[model samples]
Target: MNTPTKRRGCFRNGCLALVLLPLLIFAGLFWAHRSSQALPDRFVLVVPLSGGIDEVRNESSSLPFLPSHESLSLQELLFVLNHAVADERVREVLLDIRGIHTSPAKIAELRDAVEKVRKGGKKVTAFLRSAEDADYLLATACNSIIAERGGFLLLDGLKVESLFYTSPLGKLGVQVQAAQWKKYKSGIEPFVRTGASKEYLEQINALLDEFYDDYLGYVSKRRGMSRSSFEALINNDPLVSAKKAQTLGLVDGIASFWELQRQLTRKVSGKELARDNDVFVSGARYRSAVAWPQKGESDERIAVITMSGMIVHSAGEMGEGIDIEMLKNSLDAALEDKAVKALVVRIDSPGGDALASADMLQMLDSAAVKKPLVVSMSGVAASGGYMAALAGKTIFAQPLTITGSIGVYALKPNISGLAEKIGLGRDVVTRGQYADASTPFKPLEGQAYNKFVGASGEIYDDFVGKVAASRKMSIAAVDSVAGGRVWTGSRAMKAGLVDRMGGLFDAIHAAQQLAKMDMGKKLQIILYPEQKSWFESLLQGRSASLSDRFAAAVKQQVLHELLPQRQLTSMATFYEMLLTSGQLQMLAVMPSDIIID
Candidate 1:
């Protein structure tokens, strides 16, 4: 057939495929939606936030989510927590943070959610066989925090770490090319050089100082002490003993499990209970979500979009963390709704995908045009993660919240030398120039390297310009901190990077203030999309097509294993993850390294 005839045939097929796509999508959504309604006879709200969200790196082992090393998503797992809230048949709420797994943000989120349930007249008893930061944070949110008689209460302050590679790379014939507009744009230096450059050290020390300051400040706030007092206690401060921690007002009181449970039951002796919060909400909540009047609600509306988990390029939250498509769909849906007057963006991430970050920033810029967009920083928001927040009307980061790292970087490993050494090499044939720009078959040339660096510069420029316009700061001011340099929420606020220092609840409050609502007025928060059911989880693996499983496996391995990860990286992935409210626990390191040596 001629080219025109083939094109015509292809066009005809495309139209038919388009027609069938929506029907299939609707059918699947409906099925999934309905399936969630089916509940079990007894459901235990398993809120295990013992570890931080693990990123996908090159893997040596399978099943990172398995028991040996379970990377729990305290954000996504909030559904299991729903079982404890306002349930008449759910006699009690059990919090097992003893064998903890979580980032401070997840710990805080889960803790707050648990606290809310306790406030709703339910008995919440947290049992920690031993105590760690994971146990302590969640314990504070519980009605009763029980520890083993001689268990420890590890409430130590935040610690920062970095992996220096400059020295090691030199021993080998490896060459690393690094460039950026700002002094801190040393994200690539670590791969080729060991030890940090003087400038890198200065920048990191400042950033870490701020991070530590914020952590101390926030812990003080939670513990009902002044930041000064907390700092005074932190010099050489490892909790010598749990008794000392108790004396220092780090915990309410130390008690055995039985005693803790007894106190909780007594305190919760009178309130109503249920199997799950759904029944309680159905039976006795303020107004039925089902009720509708002939007249619509007032013109006033607020859109809350959550950016959760490690942001990636694909499906936002289907099987993995933040997917741009998932978030873009949510943003588009909310924007299209006339009732949505403004948007509250919840950003939670440790950053990923520089290109993805820029794409999302464009999406946010588009959304901002139609409605006011405010960003809420959860836990650690850095690098490409913070890039996504630039388009918001205002950005909120917790005092201890990690922010900054407004930069772009890309790492392409060259295995050509290894292949040659092993006498196993592959040849490439390209139809056009630059076809091998990023291929692993050979080391990048000056031309290719220059091209990549230029691209990164363009991205960094874009990042600064957007921030400058959004925050109304000068280009120079934004440049000072834009080169993958991180900062604390407090420091960011001072630098105008973050608009306010606050928590999720505080973020909601700030959003309400922006919307001009009363301080005490309750704004009905509409969570994005919805959580999937247990059956879906069980069937999610079952329903996976060969392609889906293959994709998942690749992602799991590439991100978790093959991918050489650093502490703070990927501005793009961070932003997307915030949309889904997933946990991302990244290592403690600068975006890149710079060597003064």
Candidate 2:
């Protein structure tokens, strides 16, 4: 066919496709809705909480066109649990918590939801194989906890570990120069000190003590054990068998999957149950059926936008972190929605890219002028994460959440000695005397070093000023707590850094009150940055295709067996180079690292 003829045919095809698309979508949705409504009534809902729980559902792992059988996001699980509370068809909930791993803070949220389910008069049974500290903590909220025989209950208490790089950096002939506005800002300590400083140790120990006490108290209350005896039992036999756990009053009993199902059936329906023939509703299917609100029902909405992982200036290709532009877009959308009466910013990050944080804070502050804005800090919301929280009218955090670390630092790596050891040297040409001052071949000295000090001072002062203004404290008062020091949520609340010592639900409650919504009524939750549908994602190329994902998975396995990971070292080196070269300036990041076990 000629070019004109071909163009006309293509145009006609496009028109036809567009016209039929909505009808096709309606038909598909209608069939699925009808089938869901036709499901048999009055069955036990099996909520299988397995694998890692994420803040948001990860679309990268599943092909857009295919049905996903992956682990549920925290939001989805909460939705399911809440739905079951009012759902007449769901007689009970079987919590099949199998080999699931998550942070303690997340466990607290899940535990709260489980408690709500129980309060709603639904019996919740937890089935487990091996019970870790977090897993058991969650199971405590359930009415009955059944563990498999021979399974281990590793309830060793919490310990926080940090990594220090001062010795290693020194060996590489790199000296890190850092200045904090005051003491307690220990973010740079890891790069300059061999071990935790006395101040840092004191703060960390106090934080750990508080967290341990709270956890012990909760577990003791839930299991109906005295705190003193529970502590002794934990210390004496932290890692015990399932039977020992039952003996210690940690779990209800030991039973296999089949046995547990039979028990659940009898408990739920007061009758005998079969092996694999029970009509149990999958949590995912149940969630789909009840996730949406009833049509034409008027419910006030509170928009929740989650910012998890490192906060960066631009899009990250591989890292599962927050992007400034993406967050800005989400905020704009939430603000524009008339249905959304309030906003909640859920921040869980270790801090990054100070400039990006500033921009986001500015946007958040602007948004708050029109609507109530609240922050829910999860896990680690230090430095930039804390900065973003400042934009909220109120900040909420868990008792163990790591907050603060309001500080900035610059790292300059001088590898002159390393070059000498390798029989190599470099001579730089520059337009000005100070042009080559920060070159890697030499340590910054005199005027060059002073310039960095001045810049860091300004950044620190700016940070303190903002904190004071937002927190309604004097500059000196803010400085006392701002010196790059990390604080537990309880301490932060005492210091006026956080308004409430609670989790996301608390933040939501605060937002609801601020919006003047009916507290007893169900407030519709609207997630900002709406998840892309399969078709939308494919059209936008926001995620990888099925073939591409498979290839990447295979490549990862091959590389895992063949290569050593030097990426961490290389990334640090590159970052130092960038800072020294004046390409990247300032950082509002947590000075220390944390790993909880």
The best candidate in terms of lDDT? 2
**Model 1 TM-score, 2 decimals:** 0.66
lDDT of each: 0.58, 0.74
Predicted candidate 2 versus true structure: per-residue lDDT over 86-189, tens digit per residue: 88888888888776665556677788888989999988889877977667777788998988878988878878677778788678666566555446666666
lDDT of 2 at 553: 46
Candidate 2 — which residues are off by over 4 angstroms?
Answer: 1-40, 48-52, 64-70, 98-102, 172-175, 265-278, 292-296, 518-521, 539-585, 593-597
User: For residues 347-422, what per-residue lDDT tens digits would candidate 1 score against the true structure?
Assistant: 7765566566668788988988887778888767777678788877778776656678787655554545555666
Question: Which regions of candidate 1 fall more than 4 Å away from where they truly are?
Answer: 1-49, 53-96, 99-127, 137-145, 155-157, 164-181, 214-255, 270-301, 315-319, 425-433, 510-521, 534-597
The clash count for each model shown is 57, 5
TM agreement with the true structure for every prediction: 0.66, 0.83
- Lowest lDDT 10-residue stretch of candidate 2: 564-573
